[model samples]
Target: MARAPSSIVVFIRQNPRTRQKPNNQIRSLTFENKEGDCGNEETKPNPHREPSQNAQNEFTEIAKEVSKITRTKPRWEQTLLSDFPSFNFSDHRFLNEVMKHQNNVLLSLRFFHWLCSHRGFSPDSLSLNALFDALVEAKACIAAKDFLDYTGLKPEAASLECYIRCLCEDGLVEEALGVFDRLRGVGVCPSIATWNSALSAFLKVGRTDLVWKLYVEMMESGVFTKVDVETFGYLIQAFCDDDQVLKGYELLRQVLEDGLDPGNAAFNRLISGFCKERKYTKVSELLHTMIAKNRAPDIFTYQEVINGLCKKRKSLEGFRVFNDLKDRGYAPDRVMYTTMIHGLCKMGLLGNARKLWFEMIQKGYIPNEYTYNALIYGFCKIGNLEEARKLYKEMCDRGYGETTVSYNTMIAGLCSKGRTDEAHKLFAEMPCKGGVRDVITYNTLIRGFCKEGKIVESTNLLNELLVQGLQPSTSSFTPIIKKLCQVGDIEEAKKLWNDMQSRGLTPMVYTQEHIITGLYEQGYVEEGMEWLLEMLKHKLKPREDTFKRLVHRLLQRDQSDDSLLVLDFMLKIGYTLEKGIYASLWLLNFAKRIPDLPKHD
Candidate 1:
């Protein structure tokens, strides 16, 4: 016990916070060690001895190794809410992204909500302008309204601008005006975009008067910092489209007055407008202007000019334009050639059209479907059915498949020339020859049958259509009914009308009137009057001729009282009775040799 191990004391001093008291615990450990170390006791290692300082160093080294193995800087981190304080909506790049990708309405709304919530922006914050823009790009008007209502957001000028644009794009001009009124009530003056949108809408729906008023209003607002090309361009287009080429010229003057040169698109629109109005002199003046301005004409400009000249029956002038286009190193495409062909054909120069067709082929420019159709139609129009058929066969042989137009031309040609057998044969062979018969085809064939006094055959064809699962339209029934009435097949015509009604197809006014006329012509005056009254009951007024014919037919049968009754009914229903009606009724009453006149009720 004299010299206790110094290591134990060192360990106790190092772990001095241990619960063992240093004095008693050290003394008891020393006494036990001395007793165990008696001469007869074997020397034993001290199991309770504290670890050496080297062991603590090794533990520290392992922890450093562990940290080195597992730790590194992260690549990315979550962005905090306070990052971007101001976001622009009209930024072009951002707009492109919104348009190109964020097209869904719900996703846009959710993104807007996240933006509003995270940015802590007020409901009226300008930062939310992009969200409104996104709604427009997505065409989500209902969502936009919901967003405004849910956020208690008052309409800002930008919001109004977006709403007006969306509404105008959807052709809801009246609704757009209501939004403009709302903007004015809110004291939010519209921006250029908003004014332009309203102007465009007015012009689109042919409200030129309103467009001019808006233009004056916009000029007076003193808000336009600059007049853009698009502003004048749209105005010029509106003027030209509305058939006011002179006014369009005035607008061009205004553009020049404002120190702006009209661009090609603007000039083209003016030229096109003049061309459409057949004002070739003005078109020429504009073309010279374009040349003086060094604005090279594109294909569309040339087409317009050529087509304009052609429409005026100036094929030689059109050919001059065509040659001019060719000499300018611009290859004459199908449209240019088609214009020439159409012009030539219209001028009764089908031979030239055929010549141009051959030239087109020689130049390795294959005639398009429209070109072939035009030639065939031109031939048919001049009663050259044989040539039309020959052309049709050539078109087929050249691997140019026939369209509904091709068949229609051939069938209509044959029908016009009273070649019903051949027309019917071609019509029947249409589907088998890889051609699908559309409504026009059926209408053409039906009309052909009716024209040939084959009412029963035409009716059978109509039935065949129904059996083949094809639905005939109002147009389909109209001509057939008219022809049937023309042939005095009133009973069958009425049956067809009933069939139409049963199939949920309402006969057009013309169709019904035709049947009524047919009834009158067939000496069914009472039935005609009854049907006319039925038409009036259903709010379908008969035309002037239909009423007069029915009344005259009734009177012809000495039914003056019935005629007067129908006439009174016509007048009571706000229809003006023609003077001929009363004269006819008076003459018929005078001519009648009735022994006893029927007393009025």
Candidate 2:
């Protein structure tokens, strides 16, 4: 008979295996033919053929088992092409996995391209949806739209929802509405999820009218899915934001009527909004209602009430609330204590605020930046700069960075104490990280320089302010002019007045009066008269006392004609020139040998 075809065939090269152990060894034996003349069938049973075929079958079985084990393992562990087999182009889960690990959308796109090119798969709805979600989450709406257009994928409700959410989050509510319309055009009915999402978007941006309309539409459509908690919470928030607290309460009542229990977050938001509006009585009632409903105030609720009371200057009431919170076993955390302390300090109750501060420390609450700042400001307000400085140093030693308020307080305190040099030193040493110095800092330093009789230095500071792109307030210029007048620097005072006018800082009536008085005091009678005329041109009446002093001084200096002119001007201006006019006329007669001074205008 012809030799049988080889039973074993090698499709692929076999992997090498280690030698077998003694327990795994195979035994071989030879058998003699019991019946003679059995021809080829009796031949030794073709040991090589049987062994080889059996070994080949065993290898095939083992290979299949290994493949099954690998296939059952997690997708992440498998080799890319070997186990991936085919790309699930429509699976958003894969895209989400791509996005979750790889933040780059472009990289994700390239990955999809590679999958299509190498795996011979085209992009499907699920893949497009995944890309859309990834882009929405990443806030790349425009890119997502471009990709969808490129892939020619129709907009599904899920994809539209994602796009609409992204648009709303980006404050493009109009665009979101357009997308919703497009979704409707596609014949996809809006689910409750869709309406709720749109309604929430409207609520977030204070579009209450639109929210109500949407709610009505949703109800009339008879597609009643459960209204999400977020929908109710945002609606309440919108009402509160619009100062419609009563309306919000009414809505909450409606929620209950609808058999939906308002969640804690909704209650908290409503109460916080009421407190913000200073509707304290309403807030109290809401608190009671929450309690009656077995919903205790959360930390945020307690903090909100405390903050509101403090803001309204009802510190005593705030303290009571604090005590009530503590009695109810809700420990006042650091923020609560800080809020109370700050409020008390603002009310000038420094002693009480300090006591609370100590109590907070004793209660194991570490003082934070706000606590220290409040204490510093309180001490400063009470004129206890020494204590404020001590606390400031303590803050520095503890490595807390000096905030702008902290630096400003110290600078202002030093200036108030007439310690300009120390103030300047501290200001110069201020760390640059707190951003550029504000206008208040510049104003304070300039005013301090003026107070110290350092007019040039003050002017230089003003110049520095200009160089630094800062505009000086009217008050910033007032002190310098006042300082010049106080020191009898008439010429410099006049220059400053001109400078102020040039800079469009219209001199107030009081400021012009100061300049006139300064000129007169410095014996610049002619200049003083000019300023008085300017004041009159601006429709400002000079004080009677100032006019009397000017006239008397002019007459004493033998300037009788000038004195008479001022008296005539005073009469023209409707000033009551009784004693002042008589005194001036008397002085004029004595100076110029005239019997009476001309007073008729």
Candidate 3:
């Protein structure tokens, strides 16, 4: 047979004298399985059996044996024992090969311990990693833990690092930390990768405090000859990404103060963080620090600065930075232009904003949705309604499907100019124009109808929505309800009122109270009292004035029976009656004149 590569093992380390010779000569061990897939024969050879069949047989037998032994407790000892069943490896490579297809990690761990304790066996790093990797990939955390604490298994530091990384990838940070401390406790010297892995796991869970502590411990432990620059970069990210920029800055500055070079990414992270927090002053300072330390600032560094300027409403400053970037020969990307456009729009500098808009198109940049909205909104804000309309049509003609925002903006602009009829036209045609209208769209159009006192049109639109199987929001109905009540159309108002319940839309105070007030004002006092009872049913308290008005109206009608009921309901809801109402209640209840004491009678 040809020699295998130096990487693969032909024989494992064991006592040479204990090596067993095969009883039969090695035969061709390949076979076709049920799926016609080829695999190696299990080392157990029955001449009648195919090799592939034997590999499966070996796995099943080992699984059965492991299941049998671990079902009962292990008889563990400081040293190997002939009697301890869990320590039985089945005395073959069966356990090792069995790990390849096994996801039952605890069973694998038991076999792993047995392999480690088996005398004359020195398991290589490959075997150690294979089993542990299987455990983690199977998400057998408890099993991985068992393997970690297996007193008989002593994997080297290199093999242990791999296990730690798998734990981190699973977001099993806490478990990874336990394994890290345990490996080091066993006199295994961890490298920088090991320490960083632990830090990364803590960071994954937003545990910045633990990350800081772990970093300190890594430095003090001095196990590694050098820490990687990426270590500090990750720590900075954890802090800054959590919006703890100051903490990140403190960590970076502390390392720099200690003369530790955590590399350029450290400076870059702080610059980005400072920019994110809109701390323009600190950003500038950090940029200068980067230059002083001979760190090269990339395009990203400049972009963040410009973005910060834009975010802080310093458009002129952002343009200045943009100019600096151009001078440094870094061609500005779309984001930079968008930021500049956004900043200008915010400052009401529409003329400049439009100029940049054309400039961006000329430079072969297609403006995105936000870019269009900003320009349209700018025109609307400056009272250039016609210009806003022209641009909105241009947006649609360019195959730009109208966003809810774009449509709402147009409606809002038209409504602001009292051109609500045109606003309704645009809204009614949104679906045909490939624009989807959400609740905001309906709310905006309904608001326009209510503003123009066109309640009929608003009600029609609401009915159309219901026909289309869409539910109306509070804004959808509240304005129309208020306007109908304003016109004293109580019957129609009552129709809408009942419709609210049938649609499973609960009428709020604005709806319920407005209807009650209109009914009461129109001498629908007895019916208005019914509305209050309904309000109480929904656990919605009537306004105090509404309550008091109803009580007074009921007493005026000589319906003291209803008035007393109202008073009791009010008191139950923690409302104090007006002193006069209380006096009336006293006269109605106990302060009436008796025949013997009624001299005035």
The alpha-carbon deviation from the true structure for residue 47 of candidate 1, after best TM-score superposition, in angstroms, is 59
lDDT of 3 by residue, 1-601 (tens): 2221222111111211221221111111112344223333344333343345545565456555444554344432233244433433443344554454333444445545555554655555555555655555555455555555553456556656767787777787777777678776986667787778778777768787778777766767785347766687787887887788988888888777767777766676777778767787888788887787777677777777777777778888888888778888887777777778878877889888888889889999998777777788788777789899888878878877887889988888787777898888888788887778877777788888888899988888888777777778777788888889889898888888787778788677868888988887788997888888888998897878878888888776667788889888888989888899977766765634445565674
- Candidate 1 is scored at a TM of 0.54
lDDT by residue (1-601, candidate 1, tens digit) is: 1211244334333533332112221122111122233222112123333223443233234323322221221110122222222333222222223222332333334434433443223333432454555555555555555566666656557667878888788777777777777776776778776777787788788887777666776666665556577778878987887788889888887776777777887888887777777778888887787777677777888887887778777788888889888888988887788889978876777888898898898988888778888898889879988888788888888878877778988888888888888989988888888888877788788888888788778878877877778878876677777887888777777777887888898788889889888878888777777788889889887777776777778767777878778878777767787777778777776666556768899
What value of lDDT does candidate 2 attain over all alpha carbons?
0.69
Q: Which stretches of candidate 2 lie over 4 Å from their true place?
A: 1-105, 111-130, 133-142, 145-153, 166-178, 184-229, 256-259, 415-421, 432-601
Clash count in backbone of candidate 3: 2
What is every candidate's alpha-carbon RMSD to the true fold? 21.4, 16.5, 15.3
Q: Compare candidates 2 and 3 on TM-score and give the better one.
A: 2
lDDT of 2 by residue, 1-601 (tens): 1111121011001211212111100011111223233234321223223323343343334334433433333332325445434323233223333433343444455445445554334554655655656556656555565656557777667768878878777767667777766876776657666677777778767787777666665566555456666677777877777778788899888887776777777777777777777888888888888887787779888898898888888888898889888888998899999999988987889988988899999999999888898888788777788999999999878877877777877888788878889888877876554524777887888898888889898988888878988777777778888898988887787787788788888776777888888988888888889888878787888887778878888877877778788888877877767775677677657655655667898
Ranking of all predicted structures according to TM-score, beginning with the best and ending with the worst: 2, 1, 3
User: Candidate 2, clashing residue pairs?
Assistant: 90-126, 90-127
Candidate 3 Cα outliers beyond 4 Å, as residue runs: 1-131, 134-160, 167-190, 197-210, 216-225, 238-247, 250-265, 272-279, 383-601
